[model samples]
Target chain A: MARILIIDDEEQLRDLLKQMLSRDGHEVVTAFDGVDGMRVFNQFNPELVITDIIMPNKDGIEVITELLCRNPNVAIIAISGGRRAITAEFNLESAEMLGVKGILSKPFTRDQLREAVQHALGL
Target chain B: MAIKTKNIIDFKSEAGRILLTSMGALLLLMVSAVFLSSYLETQLGSFKEVVFLGLAMVIALGAQWFLLKTIQSPQVLSPEERVHTTNEKLRHILNSITRQVESALGIKNTAVGGIENPADMLAATLIQCVAIMSEQVQSLLSALQMGSNESLEEARQSFIPLIDKTAETITQYLHVSQNIDNQLRERINETQQLLLNLRRELATVPQNQQQDTSQLFACIRQMGDVLETHLLIDNVVKKQLEVVTHDTNDSAFTLITLMRDLSDQAGNLVRYITETISKINAMENGVDESVGYIVRIGHFIQDIPEKIQRDIQAIQSASGVIDSLSYLVDSIKEISFQTDILAVNAAIQAAHAGDAGLGFKIVADEVRKLAVNSNKAAEMIEAGLDTARHTIHEGLKFKFLEEVMQQMNEAAQMMDSVKKLQEGHEDMRQYYKTLFTVINQSNMKLAQDISEILGSIQYQDIVRQRIERMQAAMQRRNELLQEFAIQLDVTSGNNMDDFATALNAVLNGYLEEESYHGNSLNSSDDGDQPPKFELF
Candidate 1:
């Protein structure tokens, strides 16, 4: 089992992801945004991180950059439900350009999440 | 040897000696009586009878004394010798009786080797010994009836050993039986304690099971609540998607219509500018022709005064041409004004299109500026026409052909301004074409964005399906837990096989559903594509 951190402004999606990952025997922690996520990341020292792109305080790109700076090998999976003129593809592509371990569009399935997590963790 | 001889009589030897002595004395008496009888028959017969009777009495007395002395010799044993002899006899009788009892009971070998259920064996041996004793007692009674003192004494001594042996056997049997009884009681007590412990352990099973069942029920309730929340979230997301989809579709349609209108307006404005350019070119040609005629008129007046009237008619014709050119300029000005109005309307429509029409709006502004420039050129041409018309009428009224020559210069300048206006109109036409292209590209991008938005809306349905699957699994789990709870309440038996089976079935069902849904979600169905994921 791996320790994972999830950062997202959507409470429902965060909780849902937590439940799904927890069922897979992983220890999961959640944060409301990138700011809280970073704080939790330091304290939790998780093996993997799953974050949403668009959020209130801080966004996924900033979080990915900061985490990569701290530990370049840290596994990160970026997820996004694009807003306004921005598409999820664009958001994910941007995160991918930053060298994230994995990317997923919003409303992803459990299997998809599991596969991404496996890929990120190199399992 | 002495004690044995003293205590026991030699009855056979003594009886033989006594019989021999009695017979010999009787024979002696008989002989005396016969001799005397024979002599007396001759001399004294009565004296012979008296001598025979006296000799027989003497023989009987001698026999009695000899038998008494022989029997009395053994009867004189010492008291100590008698007791020792009796004890020895008793011991011999006891040993013989014990051997008989052991042989009868088949216990001699068993006693040496040891036996199971010794108490039972001892009791059976004691019973058999008593039977032997009974036979001995019957023999003793027969011996007493026969008046045999020696046999009676031997029977009495044997009976004592038999009675004592039976009593000892019974006591040993009792001791063995008591030992067996105590062992049995200890085992019974141990068994009772074991049963009490088992009962106590069993008593706690129901309580512990009840607690576990309650915990299971609570978990089931929690799952139910989560399912309900998922359902609510699904509904809300779906409704929100519907609203967003509707609004996006309406906006897209409105934007498309507005773009179409703007494109048509741009096309119309380009066409108008083309026509206005042609009109301005034709009017410029007319102005140049009029200038040519006026110059010729100046030359005619210089050459001959007699041709002045002819030149006057020429000047009049040129003035009429100038009048028509003024009308053409006015028409061009009107077209320019119409183009300006169209540009302003296109700009308003572009503004309504928001961000997508920003380029279109810029082009519209350019078009409006061109229209304003066209109007300024039209006013310049009309003013030039007025100058030509005023110069022609002055030349005709004053009869001075020099003023008409100056009218030619002003007309040439007006022709240059008209040519410039025609060039400006040409530039406006190209700008309008570029604007149309910009608008077309913007509209295409907008349509694509709208399609993407429609595709993104499918995420809601996907989420709803996932939630529904979870709800189904939760419902099944709850049902199984309820059945387990009922089973617990119904029976106190620790039969958990049924509950375990049911629980496994529920878990398997949930896992199967999840796998099926996962596969379905990953599978492509027509235009329904799986979610995009990437490992970078």
Candidate 2:
């Protein structure tokens, strides 16, 4: 099982991810904002970080940069949900540049997340 | 590959004749083309006589006649004839489908007058369902927006519980945060008062020490010593204050972030509710389309039961003629699938039997195409009927409707809970803000007091220490004055006592009467000073 950190401003979404991912036997930790996320990330150094793109006190990109700076070997997963559909989301190419190991659009199913994680880990 | 060569009407043979006719036309065409080419060449100065071209054309025509009866067009249906004929049959198919639609859906459909195409009829019916459902979906969405207690009859029944669960979660978090706010405010208020008390304790000294010779001198000496030590007290106080202020600031930041998070949670709930309702709509629409497709399937099955019985009689009558016709035995059997199939097959074979079968073959092809279409229509009708029966049987069951209505009601209840929870969360946010403002104002006042005290303490220490030092050195010299100005008691030690006392009296009076440069910090030793809660 992979250890995962979920970062989002929405607590319910955090809860939702926790329920879904943990039921698959993955260990999950949650943070509600970018700063707390960085703190928890540094402390836990979880195998994977699943973070929402929009946040305060340093957003997803900033967090990714800081995390990778601390440990370049770290793997991260960034996600963006349509706060509005047809609007620009977290750019996939940009996330790749920031060392994101995977990206997902939000409200995704378990199979999609699992498949992406498995592929990224080469499992 | 029908092997029947019986006068299965020779339309193809007639087509062969038509090809012979076309071959005759091509010969004429070739001759004209050569003549025209030679004429053009002569006009362009390339030829004087066209005799060579005329002689060549006569030879080609003679050759074309033999080509005619030989290969010619094999007795197949011409592409143009096939299209013209199929268009006529397709119109019939369209009419049949429209009738089926009429029988099944029972909607007020126009004659589909301009719509001769089968695809258009099908599309029109499907569009009918789509348009109807679109209106219903739009109304459902509007009803949801209003959150009318009774409007979303089915959905409200299902979604309410889920919304309630979400609302409960939000309320729990809000209460927790509210508790934290209350705790923090109390602690900060206490800290502020303590700071004020500390300043007062450090400001004054005891009153009795003002008049006492030894104690006054000792107190002044201690003040001189503490002037340096007081700088350390200032530094420690300043640092402790910084730590408190920093802690409060960090907590405030956390509180703000948490509040925004709560807002975000509320927003997420709203969005999720919208998405869920939309999904239900899409699902419901899908079910409705399935209903339409089922109706199409019913149209397909309606023909199967009646046509099969009619075909049984045709087969019996055709069997007798089959042996005499010899080659048409297979063709007759082919038509066993429908009344038209055998006719079409007979027509095709008759045409191939030279000129004799030509007329029959044309009829046979038309009848065969019609039979094929009818078979398809039968299948489609059967499928539609079965679909209608199965869908109605499965979907209209009491349990299914009950379950759907139950789920919808639960969803509605959940939505209500979410609304209430949002309102409660908003209140929580306001309470935090009010508490936050109070704590913030107190911290500011505390900061101001500490700042003023700290700023004044530095300057006060500098000036107070300088004066106390002067007072300490003068008193020590006064002890020296008493010793050096003592009257000579060598002649009679007892005799000089009066003189020493009188001089001491004179000195005490002068010292007591002297005025200081400014108002004293105390008229007497400063009241009720703490011995231990003193400077440090």
Candidate 3:
């Protein structure tokens, strides 16, 4: 299994994702927000990153941009639960414009996560 | 007196008087000549008469000549008369020249238009100067006439001031002419300045127009650059969107396939769990039956020790009977000793009577043989009785019945433990059954959730398509705007129809897309309706 990173503001989601990916036999790292995520990303250097679009410090778009600048071929999957005015579609489309590997809306299932991850990693 | 006569002498009247006198003289001469001619004819003949007629003709000619001279010839008068006559002629000539000058200057003709140019103004000024000189000359002539009646010194005194006044008028005219020339020069300078200002204004107009034209062209070029940038951005966005759509579609398909497989697996697991539960129930029943059989077997074995004890008591009672039989065998042995003694006494009596009692001896011997046989039978019977009693006693000595009873109680306790273990197994089976049910329910819920997630994925794709359509419409709008900008001209009025048409097309496209999606531009609420996804 590929090394994966899960970044989200929600504690439960992060833990749940970490558990799921770990169960799937992937080495998983967790972060609370985009800022911490980037720090963790730099240190972990995971093969794939699953990041939430809207976050406290650095948003998913900025993270994607920075990561792409560092490594253009880095695998990225954007997820969003949609905030007040910004819908998940808008955020995901924005991520798509930045050339993300995959995107998932909020309330996605484990299977969907696995599918997106697999697809992103070209598995 | 000569002046008065000259004034009274009319030339026509003098000519008529001279003709009358000539005629009268001729008549008189003709009469005398007629008389002379008669006398000559009577005395000296017609020659003397012709001579007298000739004399009369000469006298008539002289009279006519004298009258013509008195009537036509200027009369010689005094010097004052000559001065007055010359003064009248000069005054008349001066008045005529002034009138001619006034007429030339249009002073006499009020109908003539005024001077229009500097030349005409100069001419008018000069004519005024001439008129002043003529007036001065007229005054000089008047002064000369007036002085004719006075002394020559008086005439000189009057004439000097009048000449000086005439010279002053000529000087004033010259000065006025010079001032008019100066004013004409100033007007020419003013006109030249006006022309220069007009030329400067005319020259500035084209430069301002050129600047404005250059600015307009720059604005057009800037607009073109803006349009080009917009087009470039549109193309890039279009390409990126295509890639996103393609990736999303593939992910969706893959997700759907995974869902199907998971659903099948879940169904199979539920089926397997149900089958396992059924098998466990059957096994539980079998276990219950085995427990019941063990309980019955335990009850049956529960009394084996007591039964063994009773059988051991019966064997002990049989051992007492063997003891009684041993006592009877001792009484028989005593009888055998007594019989042997009797046989020996009979045998001694039979020997004393030997020949005479051969029969008696034979009976005694036979009795002795019988006693011996009886003694041996008794010994054998006693020995058998003793052995039977000892064996019975030994068999009752060990506690075999207590041991069998202990083993039977232990078996009964083991049956109870088996029953409890079966009860625990039933509880464990129930717990496993509940766990399987929870697992099955969770699997179903998981399937439902996955289906919902798939729906959301489809929604994402739909939103993407809508956005793509919007991008396409915006691109078309930019293209139309560029076309409009290119066609825009300030000289000619704008072709608003093209703009309106293009805008309408864009709006119609939006409306069509919205309608196709079963949405309305006026509606803001989408409710909970799931978004439909199209692969394309």
Candidate 4:
């Protein structure tokens, strides 16, 4: 089982991802935003990370960049909800450019999450 | 030429025209005084004529001073210059209006930058514009009051339409701005309602999501537990089936063995009963034979008395015959004795008649000899018959035959008792056969009941599968609830960074578009964006 981290400004989504990944038999950690996610990331040292774009303090792009800088081999899955300024597609593309391994839109299904996690963990 | 020049000068100066008119009147008075002086020298003295002349000069000097003083008052500007000066002042007021309008637009932009509601800023801008216009109107009115030239009055009269036009324009502007303000207020109110609804929904979302997530976790845990329990039950049931099957096999073996033993016993009993019945039948047949022989012997023994009785009767008849014969023989002997006597007499008589008497004596002697023979035979017969009759009487007694008959009756009674004993053995054998059949039927029923119980153990597996399916369905429902909460978060716009970024982008776009139009109306460039809308 892979150890996974979930980061999002939405607490409900964070908890949901954590629960879903945990149910797949992976160890899961959660954070509310980018800053908190970084703290939890260092503390947990998870093999995989799932993050949401357009968060407070720092967004998914910065979080991915920082995580990659710390551990070049760390895996990342980026999720985004479209806002007026940035579309979900744009955010996802940006995260991809920053070396995120996977991307998902808001309101994704359990199957989508599982597939994305599996890809991120190379499982 | 001088008159025309003087006329032109008089036309340019009201004071100069008044002075000429007063000089012409004074000259007419002097000519009239000269004529009046000759007439007055005749009527009155020279002193009266000199006083009239002095009064006329005083009148002319006073008229000149009054005309000069009236011309020197400061209301004497030219009509063209007054119109020029009034036009310049009107331009100043128009410039002030333009500046105020620009300032109002500037204030509007700056206020919009700080405020979320654009209507509030617009209203403030309109108020400032009105105030600036009011101050400029007051300044224009005071400047108009300081100079009262007749040309300025004409200029002021012409400027009335321009002020009315400015007032009309301001009124129209205020009216339009107020309408925009009202529209913006209504839109803002609607937006507030939408935001409030969103906030309320968002406020409840976390708690609801937490509860649903908890339930989901619990369901997953329950599903795990159910899986474990199902596996355990399966294992247990499998093991139980093996044990039960093994036990059933053993029991079946035992049952078959017992059935075999019972069958063997039943067969043995049936054979034994058949053999015993056959033996008893044989014994019964022997008893029947004995009974038949005893019956025959009884009948024969019963006939022996009758045969003895008949033999006695025959012997009696023989004795009777012998008695009769003895009697006859007695008679013969008597007769013979008598005949011998007679013959003796006859012979004596015959000596008397010797020859005739000789025949009679022969006859008598022959008769006497025959009679003697007859009496001797009769005596012999009577003695033989007496001996036979005594032997027959001794043999006629049935006492020994009666003892033989009693012995034959006892043998028949013994045969009947043996027949009863054989019947009792046959009845006992039938009773044992019926008991064996009942025991065999009961064993078969017990075996069937055990087999039925072993078949019913699969129901537990069915129950386990139903539980597992229910847990799986609940897990799916939990996942759906989680997705619903995520969607709620996305739509709520609770993340301020994203919300603000979206607002900025939208407002900038709106302002850029508006600025394109604003430059045409106000002759000013606007680059800064403002807040687009505000809600609760």
What are the TM-scores, per candidate, against the unseen true structure? 0.22, 0.19, 0.28, 0.29
> Where does model 2 exceed 4 Å of error?
A82-90, B1-536
Off by over 4 Å in 3: A1-123, B1-407, B478-496, B518-536
Score chain B of each candidate by TM-score: 0.25, 0.21, 0.32, 0.34
Instruction: Name the docking class for model 1.
Output: incorrect
lDDT of each: 0.58, 0.47, 0.57, 0.51
lDDT order of candidates, best first? 1, 3, 4, 2
Q: For residues B190-303, could you state the per-residue lDDT of candidate 4 as single tens digits?
A: 334333432332343234233434433332233223223322322322332232233323333343343333333333333333443454465456557655666775676678
DockQ of 2: 0.02
Pairs of residues clashing in candidate 3 = none
What is the alpha-carbon lDDT of model 4 when measured against the actual structure?
0.51
Candidates 3 and 4 compared by DockQ, better number = 3
Of candidates 4 and 2, the better by lDDT:
4
Q: Which ten residues in a row have the lowest lDDT in candidate 1 chain B?
A: B107-116
DockQ of each: 0.02, 0.02, 0.02, 0.01
Docking class of 3: incorrect
Would you give the TM-score of chain B in model 2?
0.21
The fnat score for candidate 1 comes to: 0.00
